[model samples]
Target: MLDQLRQIADGLGQTLAPFCEVVVHDLLEPDQAILAIHNSLSGRQVGDPATELGMARIADPDFTQVLANYANQFADGRQAKSTSIGIKDASGRYIAALCLNLDLTLFRGLQSAMNQFMRMDTEGPRESLDPAGGADAIRARIDAFAGRHATTPRALRTDERRALLSELRAAGLLDVRRAMETIAAHLGVSRASVYSYAR
Candidate 1:
């Protein structure tokens, strides 16, 4: 059954070739698990030792299958995205492992180009002090404060509300008379309740 699976592994390697390196490991022989390999991106040979994933399967019967993508670097320092899967026998024992390592250098270069192409000017506009916009700014600040405390603005405790008001006052947001009204409306509290928080 394991030998039959080797052809599938080889086919996968060829299909994903150039970028992908695929290897088959025989778990019974930890010292030389590499039974077959394709693409050979890692430069590992048929007689190479089992990887950490194979060793884990050997140590733990429950490690039947492991499919994870992780960062890996080749001996030549080239970065790769690797996925390893452990195959098991009928009795729940891991018998073989298959691994696919994908070179990420080309994708990373494309990502850099995409970022440059999609770049935008972040300093396009400055904020305005219009009453409606000011109210939005005040609500945004309160929401940010609530987020820091892991709660919603309406769910803030009295002490938390007091601290939030203190921060707002220190930021000069409460200097405008309508700012308190805006905060009170946003918090579902009365203007007097908002004022008490300032103390």
Candidate 2:
């Protein structure tokens, strides 16, 4: 049974290579329960002792069979997402477990990097990258419209929204490149909705 499980662990480890660690624990030998380990992220050896999870399963037959995407950390504090699956014998007693631990360091780093790359500057002086100053013009028109209506562009009423679109169209603001996108972004509506309103 353990041999078959070892084969399964190896196959899964290969498929999830370089990031995931697959461990097969022999619950019957809790003192040294780690029967096999592949991908080796945690630096755990084959004869390593069972974890608290293994002990928990041993103590309770009704313990959860599958625990997925639970937060875990290595000894060095690298973040991990893990899934643990329990195996039971013919009599329904938990016999072993298969655990997959995915190292999230690279993924977390990528997430942080992407966030930094996409973050917009909300402070300092306003700068318009548009050579036509179309964005500035749009903001000015919306501000004037809002100032006249005693409300913000996003807070404009349904009737007021139609009036505003009319005002924008008369000012040729709708003719600017990607004007619908800019207007919809400020007004918190879809481009299709903005085009519909303009019509």
Candidate 3:
């Protein structure tokens, strides 16, 4: 089954040539997981060690069918967009892995061109006085505050809540009608509790 999948990897690599690098890994051997490779963009050859993603699958059985796209770089420092998929066996153990890496240098150039074509001129912008916008802004502020403290809005302590309310009040966000109710809902707390924080 793994060998058949390696053939699929080869076909995929050939179909997406030049920009795409396809690799197949056998997870049974972490040190030499690269069973087959195509395009060879990363300069990694067969018999190479498994990547961090493969090791993660070995460590966690639940780490199956993971599909993530993130920034990657080639040996020559060229930017790439990479996507990896983990394949598991019937026993819930990861048996194989396939990764596709796409070089993005040309796409970056195209993005720059598109941006230049859609350039916008600065206009005198008017301030929004919508109550809903104010509520959203307040919620964003609360989330940001909680994130800075390494916690969620609902998980903020009393003192943290008080400080957050104070900051909202200072920013005039709490002056909007029903802003307190919105904040309370976002924090998963009662309206009375939000009032207490305001005090």
lDDT top scorer = 2
User: RMSD for each model, in Å, please?
Assistant: 9.8, 9.5, 9.8
Give the Cα-based TM-score of candidate 1 against the true structure.
0.58
- Count of residue pairs whose backbone atoms collide, per candidate: 0, 0, 0
Q: Give the TM-score of each candidate.
A: 0.58, 0.61, 0.56
Candidate 1 lDDT, 1-199, residue by residue in tens: 7787799888998899888999899999999999999999888999899988789989998764767788889989999988888887888888888889999988899999999999977889865666555777788999999999999999999999999999998988997659989999889999999989997
The 10-residue segment with the lowest total lDDT in model 1: 126-135
Q: After superposition, how far is residue 170 of candidate 3 from its true place, in Å?
A: 48
Q: How far is 137's C-alpha from truth in model 3 (Å)?
A: 33
Instruction: Tell me the lDDT of candidate 3.
Output: 0.90
In candidate 3, clashing pairs total 0
- TM-score leader: 2
Pairs that collide, model 1: none
Candidate 2, lDDT over the whole model:
0.92
lDDT for each residue of candidate 3 in 126-181, tens digit (9 for 90 to 100): 66666576787888999999999999999999999999999999999998878988
